[model samples]
Target: MLRLIIKKEIQSALRDTRIQFAGTFLILLMLVSVLVGRQGQKQIQKERAEAQATMYDKWVNQGAKHPHSAAHYGQFAFKPKPVLSFLDLGLDNYTGVSVFLEAHKQNEVLYSAAQEGNGMTRFGELTAALVLQVLLPLLIIFLTFNIFSREREEGTLKLIHGQGISMRKLLMGKVWGTYALVLLIFIPVICLAYFLLDQASAGFDPHVGVKFMGLLASYSLYLLIFVLLSVIISAFSKSSSFSLLSLLGLWIAACIILPKATTNLADKVYPTPSQYEFRKTIAEKVENGIDGHNPSDARLADLKKQVLDEYNVSKTEDLPVNWRGIAMQAGEEYTDQVYDHEFSKVENIFKKQNRVSEWAGFINPYLAIRNLSMAFSGTDFHHHVAFVKAAENYRRAFVKKMNKDMEVNDKPGTEDYRVDKEMWESIESFSYEAPDIGKIISVQWRSVTALVFWLVALFTLASIYAPKISRL
Candidate 1:
């Protein structure tokens, strides 16, 4: 009986010219977005690779210079683009792609793709994630808003109800029918995306397969939640138009208003200090004797004196090791301590920002699904932080290597010390390996759980009250 009802719903929906047109429009949009996203991804990947190669070449070809001086001339760390970032772009478009590592300072990553254009970027670019998260729900609403109310207005509900059919079966059939329609519109696009990604990245890890499949599963659940919620709204509303307006209000709150509001509220509650203020604070503390920035100060003078005495050297110059290099390395370690504290504070601020949005998942299933999708794709905040941390790690290693080289090869008070450019060529370049999809899934368990809770709550409401819908 449910199969028969579902078939009937499909046939009736197909006969509507509006449904036909909408289906065609969605397919076209998905195809266009896929092509555009793929091309952009290729271009970005090519450019970043070329930039990294050029920087490496420049450093290797640099004239002989003091190892310490070479540290001051530091190199650039270009973040590699994740293969699947083409589909969603996620925060890649908003975040910087490269960071400069130099002596005594940690530069903020530069070149945000979103900031490339004028104010128009605030509207956001077209991407698969945007379509799935923002536009697809509206399409589901359009297809399902009239599912029950239209039948009631036309006296079909009375006729059908008199046929001894339970409202539970009827609504279940309607929801399933609408879900089938959404799949028809979505499945082809997903398959096409997988094919393109496979063809483009020859060395793409198989684990990305898991991430992509999880993305599909999460999106499907999201669409199902929308379809069921719309049907319930239709069952309770007096007319089709009211069902639509109510669903639209819900969509607006979920997709547009709530995410932004929560971010703003979180910033207000746990404010992050400006970079300038943070640096100034560190500098002041260093000047006051703690000297986390420069370890060659009075606070560490005792340690230096001990080392000199142990070596039976009257001054730093008489020591066997290059004291300047040691001092520079010691200074770097101190600065690292200060940076660790500041970066932790910044991370705390971001966590607070995300917590507000995380709790919002209970009120908005779309938020839950969107976050889950990004998390699985390894394109969320966690992945971004991983990249930044990896880059910083590479920077520290490079600096320490230079310092160690200087200590071995340089004589004290001899400014004529220099290392061959070949030494720079010998150093390994930074390479990042993205975390496993399984780990990503583990980290986002809360979001998945929240979405399941939403499904359960909505299904319960529909089951208990759908029968009473006639009382309205």
Candidate 2:
């Protein structure tokens, strides 16, 4: 009986021109969006590769130079585009891609893609992920919001109901049937996009298949719960127009209004410092120690005393190694400590801000999916932080190597100490690998828990509400 009801629903829905035209138009639009996203991804990957190779070549081939000068010359670290980023851009557009690494200073990632665009770019780019996450739900609403109300108004539901069918069985069939129809268009589009991304990345992400399957599962649950919500609304509506207006209101609240509201509210609750103020705060703390003088000099004086004591010597000339190099390293160590303390406070502020949106997932599944999508794509804050810290560590190691080399080879007070190109070439270039998927999932467990709650609630509501249709 369930199978028969499902078959009847599919046959009737296919007969409607609105359903046919919508499915065809959306499928075509999805294909175009996929092509656009693929081309954009390919171009970025190529550019990053070329720039990284060029920078490494320049650094290795640099002629003989003073060790300190080479530290000042620095190098650029180009972040590679994650293989799965093409599927869902996430925060990639918002965050910077390249970092300038140098001694005595920590640099922020520079050159975000969004900064180059016009005013309209703030609204967002239309990728295939956007089409599925935003537009396809509207398509689902259009097809299902009138499912029961139209039949009730046309007197078909009365005839069917009089044929000894309970509303539960009817609602069950409608939910399953509508889901099947959505899958007809939805499944193919995902498979097509995944295939294109897989080939486009040339197998960079061996876990691409796993990631796509996870996406498939998320969308499947999202569509099922959404259709059930629409059907329950249709069952309660007096007419088709009312059902649509109600569904649209729900969609707007879920997709559009709540996102902006939550973000603004989070900002109000946990504001971030302005750029100038943040930097100024750090600088002030470093400068005004017991006396308003160079904190680096104070730190260097203490470092020289320690080195002299360690070597059991009272005079600089008696020490076998150069105290100047060691003093410079100690200065940077103190500066790094100051930056680390201040930066951690800033990081804590940002974490509090994000917690607002993370918990908002319980109220809005769209927020849940958005966070989860970005995290899995390696474009979220966690991924960005990992890359940045990795670069900083590499910079520290490189600078320390250069300092130690100078201390061993150059005499104290020698201002023109230079190292051969072989020493410079010994420094390894930076490389970054995206964090493991398990780590990303662990960080986003709040969203996963929220999605589970939504699924269970929708199924429970379907069972409870479908039987309440005791009126016309």
- Minimum summed lDDT over a 10-residue window in model 1 is located at 287-296
Q: Which TM-score value belongs to model 2?
A: 0.94
RMSD of each: 2.1, 2.3
Return the clash pairs for model 1, or none.
none
Clashes of 2: 0
Top candidate when judged by lDDT against the true structure:
1
State candidate 1's TM-score: 0.95
lDDT of every model, 2 decimals? 0.81, 0.80
Local lDDT at 416 for model 2: 79
Per-residue lDDT over 264-326 for candidate 2, one digit per residue giving the tens place of the 0 to 100 score: 998999889887887887777566542346565576677788888999999877788877677
75-145: candidate 1 lDDT, tens digit per residue: 88887777777667777767788999877777787887777757767677777888888888888889888
Off by over 4 Å in 1: 202-206, 289-296, 413-415
**Model 2 whole-model lDDT (C-alpha atoms):** 0.80
Model 1 clash number? 0
